[model samples]
Target: MSRLTQAVVLLLFGGAILRASLTDLYLRYVKEGLRPFLIAAGVLLIAAALATLWYSLREGETPDDHHEHDAPASGAPGDDDGHGQGHHEPRVGWLLILPVLGLLLVAPPALGSFAAGQAGSVSAAPASDSDYPPLPPGDPAPVGLLDYASRALFDDGKSLTGRNLRLTGFITPASDGSPMLARIVLTCCAADGRPIKVGMTGKVPLEVPADAWVEVTGVYSPHRAKDPVNDVDVAYVEVTSWQEVPEPKQPYS
Candidate 1:
């Protein structure tokens, strides 16, 4: 890896970051809050590449004026050419191409069921005195999975009772074939994503394949179970109807 290769690698990596940020493709793997940082970092990397290119070119053009006196006292081990201008040869820098190719080509996907299984599942612990805000005005109120989980487990379903709520998320089936509608919440980025899941009871929703996004209309079941793993309550929803829906522009909550 020469300085030229280093610059090219930087250019590729930075281009991938800038492209992901500008095209809205980044939302799939990172939080929108990172937009500014991504842009700044990308621009800096691209600048480094351009600067390296300019230096390389300038170094190439002045060979006639070059002299052994220009060479540093101790040249690099292989550079017997005492004129002092040879690549530093950053062999390890080649490793940067792996992430560059990953981001540019596969563009890697958000973590899904497999990751959820490995991660410690989130469950809100039962709280007898938890206070919850009133559900916003709607017949079948639109609610988020995180909010619903908190209410169901801590507030004893006070906010959820008798209200048919609409919750949208992708499906992840349990090993026993029971389907769980799950939403991954990202605090900073997809690397830190965690799954909030609820078991759904409905013939139609169960039929939807894993990773298919859908909107579920349902009422929360009063009966909640204490999950031993996280010592948090796991809520259940009885779906009245469901339909496949386009994935939201920003999938993370």
Candidate 2:
């Protein structure tokens, strides 16, 4: 392919990434914190393409054929000398368009229940020196699903008991055995996301299918005594109430 064609490919690829980052579609693939880096990478690629086109036109960018030794004279369409520096660009390069088009046209959804099911064993509370803090003053103290799980599973449910906290997440059927609250936790991006879950209790009924977003309110229900060997992260919440809600802007925690 001509230098112009190569430059065009770079331009289009960069522009696609830039558009994805600007519109927050990038969240579907990567963490929100990567926005700045994504934008910078896209801009750099566009600049490189523009520079290539500018210099190629100025007749100063591409080096003159300062062949140390004469290249074997150009051969027939299908021929090649020992150093087959074929003039045609490799066809494999075209495969790159798959991701660009997928991002541009389809805008795939974030990793959800399907991914959660494939995740490995449950995650324990990350090590910490201090005790879990008390819920800040509020009627239904808003909290994350992972946060509640950690406190319940590892801390013997001390911090969570009697505190009417609120947790929002997508449904993961049978948190312990029945439909319960859950959220996907990402160590970096969707590729590494793991599901954190909490069983639900109390008077309200839960009828949502897996992946349905909801906000649940209640205190933690007493479960089997915490065992050091077996994780109780699948602790239950006495759901005084809950309601379906729109999914969050960033689905994974």
Candidate 1 lDDT score relative to the true structure: 0.75
The 0-to-1 C-alpha lDDT of every candidate, in the order given, reads 0.75, 0.72
Over 32-92, each residue of candidate 2 has an lDDT whose tens digit, in order, gives: 8989999999999899989877866776433323231233456655346446653433468
1-253 per-residue lDDT for model 1 (tens digits):
4556666888898898888888778898888888898899999989998998688677763422233434445545745655656534335857879888887887566677666555555755443554676788887899888778878766768778989899998888764667777888887988788888777765447567888889989988665554444555567777898899988888887
Candidate 1 error regions (>4 Å): 61-92, 125-130, 202-204, 226-231
Error of 2 at 98 (Å): 1.5
Model 2: weakest 10-residue lDDT segment is 61-70
Residue 234 lDDT, candidate 2, scale 0-100: 66
The numbered model that scores best in TM-score is 2
How high is the lDDT of residue 112 in model 2?
Answer: 66
Q: 178 in model 2: Cα distance from truth in Å? A: 2.9
Superposed on all Cα atoms, the candidates' RMSDs to the truth, in angstroms, are 4.8, 4.9
Model 2 root-mean-square deviation: 4.9
lDDT of 2: 0.72
